[model samples]
Target: MEVFKQHCQIAEEYHEVKKEIALLEERKKELLAKFEQAEKEKLDAAQLAREYEALAEENRTLKLAQSQCIEQLEKLRIQYQKRQGSS
Candidate 1:
């Protein structure tokens, strides 16, 4: 009877350990998924940073072009004034 009780106790311990292992495995899977999601977000943020840099460069070029146009307009106005003064 003692031997039978020992066997039953071992079986119960075995089942509890098995259940604990299953729960740990599930937790590990959930953690892995979260890690993957974080990595994806990191990649997306890097891509967005690159795109923003490109936009800033484009804006700089546009501003330079606008300045050049203003300079040309000023030169034309000066020439027109010189003509009127001569006439």
Candidate 2:
């Protein structure tokens, strides 16, 4: 009778261990998915940062060109005014 009880106890322990292993496996899968999502977001953020830097450089170049054009326009206006005044 003791041997039968021991066998029963071992079987019960084995079932509990299996259940715990299954739960752990499911948790591992969830954590892996979260890690993959974080990695993708990191890559996307890096790409956006690069694009922002490129756009900022383009904006600076455009502003510099605009300033030069405005200066040229002012010079031309002054010359035109002088010629008209002489006439």
Candidate 3:
């Protein structure tokens, strides 16, 4: 009877260890998936930053061109007014 009780206890302990191992394996898989997702997001963020920088440079160029055009138009308007006043 003593040996039988010992055998049953050992079996129960074995089953508990297996259950714990299975739970740990599931948690490890979940963590790995999260790590992969984080890496993908990092890559996407870097790409967006590059695109934003390109667009910002283009906007600066356009603003400079617009300022130049306005300066030229102002000069033309002043010349026309002077001509009209002289005539």
Worst 10 residues of 3 by lDDT: 31-40
Residue 51, candidate 1: alpha-carbon lDDT: 100
Question: What is candidate 1's lDDT per residue for 16-35, written digit by digit as tens?
Answer: 99999999999999999999
What value does the lDDT take at residue 52 in candidate 3?
Answer: 100
lDDT of 2 by residue, 1-87 (tens): 999999999999999999999999999999999999999999999999999999999999999999999999999999999999999
TM-score of each: 0.82, 0.83, 0.71
Structural RMSD, model 2:
1.7
Give the clashing residue pairs of candidate 1, or none. Answer: none
lDDT at 49 for candidate 1?
Answer: 100
Candidate 3 Cα errors over 4 Å, as ranges: 1-10
Cand. 3 Cα-lDDT = 1.00
Q: Relative to the unseen true structure, what is the C-alpha lDDT of residue 13 in candidate 2, on a scale of 0 to 100?
A: 100
lDDT of 3 by residue, 55-85 (tens): 9999999999999999999999999999999
**Runs off by more than 4 Å, candidate 2:** 1-3
Worst 10 residues of 2 by lDDT: 31-40
Model 2 error, position 40 (Å): 1.4
Ranking by TM-score: 2, 1, 3
RMSD of 1: 1.7
